[model samples]
Target: MLWRATDRRSANPLRTGLRWLLSLAFGYAGYRHLATPAPFLAITPPWVPEPALVVAATGIAEICGAIGLLVPATRTIAGGALALYALCVWPANFYHAFAHVTVGSTTLGWGYHAPRLAAQPLIVWWALWASGAVDWPFRTKARDG
Candidate 1:
């Protein structure tokens, strides 16, 4: 089981709002991936054995994770899963940065890629925080039993 805050009673407005916003973003991105996978395929690492299948699977997972986040019953599981998913797919981000891959006309450079690479942890934290999987500032360390 993934780490989660013990205090489920406390639900902050800001966190909830951010979570919803992210969900919308993910949902849209997922839809785009399903509708037009060419851009995603462009970012796929050359080493990947089957880029098309991977892209489709990742897109489906993202959509599911986004949907899971909205439901209170499955929020924690969804959060943990999404965090793991982000970690798993980070290689693509790294490849994009290192290779300076371009989708259509715009090429991704250090300015865009560096921050994206650096913000991965932040993305994981955001997923956890927004899903109420891990509370911070208000609560950091998990409660000791």
Candidate 2:
């Protein structure tokens, strides 16, 4: 087994796999946010004071959080930070959904955007759970012997 059977410190394979997948996703998304930012800028709410700066900062945070998630020592902190980051970005998702933001030939309509909005909390929870930053109802049982 990849994870230790008796060692509580070693996360189960499911969580580990989820962690890696989320890290990769965040890393790639971050790169996209920086490398080609026009789409992101288009989705930025007009109410935001400095859209470009926020985009850049969020990209940087995503990349850093991705790296942190892979390191055991930093995993929990990274998870918490990522959870907060996801929450912070929720408004942008809402803006995109409501504004019907367009990028190239594709306009993000309600059908495409509503599910993403609904999934935001799951993303945050995934980060927290995968990194073992917060596990309540899912806590494992200790050996009684």
Candidate 3:
């Protein structure tokens, strides 16, 4: 069956809101990644091959996924892709935190790093929920069992 924002029994305001918000966030981040990749490059793990190419590819992926999230036909796949994308980039986040990556003479403290690391899972969840891929903590039991 084709998935849509209203695929559930009723419309979910929270899901709609998160979908738009995440789309905007990813779209902007994608633009920034393409426009200036220096910061991203700084945090990239040494093991990654062709950091520049990967950064550019990620930018394209982000932009495409962000656009896909809004289209009913592609929303589910987009959400899944984005969730995986977020997971894939986590190593860079860890590198940034532990390596004390400096971008433009500014090294983010643990205060910033900690919350960002913590938010990764939430981001993954948001994409899934917003795209109607899975609903948890909000799904009502049938007849209260």
Candidate 4:
């Protein structure tokens, strides 16, 4: 809590590598959900209209963000987009946790989905920071005494 330099470096290579791996995996999963009617349907709340279209858009966003992270010029945008994408699907994750969204007769518990979903923003931020998309905001400032 006293130094701003704690976050002075860009993401380490191993961590950055992991970020890309996670991004690729997540993007693929999103694409799968978009491709299959059953998975897409499972997440759509009754209140939502045009569930298929929404799923497709989400899938596209995931793909774009995953690709964006690979390009330095687009890394920041990708991170931001990924974060936004995570927020967009939050309701679906919540619904699943509460059993409001059922994938077949199986519903995923919060324990399974929440940590990764909830950690997404931090992940995005870490990726962007690691990719050197921007300066770390307050490593020293926060620790200033």
Best by TM-score: 3
Q: Write the per-residue lDDT of candidate 1 for residues 6-78, one digit (tens) a residue.
A: 2352267787788898788778878888999998899999999899998998889999999988888788888
Report lDDT per candidate.
Answer: 0.82, 0.84, 0.88, 0.66
RMSD of each: 3.2, 3.8, 2.2, 5.5
- lDDT of each residue in 1-145, candidate 2, tens digit only: 3223322433678788899999999999999999998888988889988889988889999999999999877887898899999999999899988877788779867778879999999999988887776665576576322
Residue pairs with clashing backbones, model 4: 1-143, 2-143, 3-139, 3-140, 3-143, 4-139, 4-140, 5-140, 11-130
Better of 1 and 3 by lDDT: 3
lDDT winner between candidates 3 and 4? 3
Q: Rank the candidates by lDDT, best first.
A: 3, 2, 1, 4
Cα shift from native, residue 69, model 4 (Å): 0.4
Candidate achieving higher TM-score, 3 or 4:
3
Q: How well does each candidate superpose onto the true structure, as a TM-score?
A: 0.87, 0.88, 0.92, 0.71
Task: Please give the RMSD of candidate 3 to the true structure.
Answer: 2.2
Q: Give the per-residue lDDT of model 4 (tens digit) for 1-145.
A: 2122323332456646756785786679677866776877786766677888887777787778778777655666676677667777777766666665667777677677778567766765665554445445734655444
Candidate 3, 81: how far from true, in Å?
0.4
Error of 4 at 131 (Å): 4.6
Clashing pairs in 2: none
Native-to-model Cα distance after best TM-score fit, residue 109 in candidate 3, in Å = 0.5
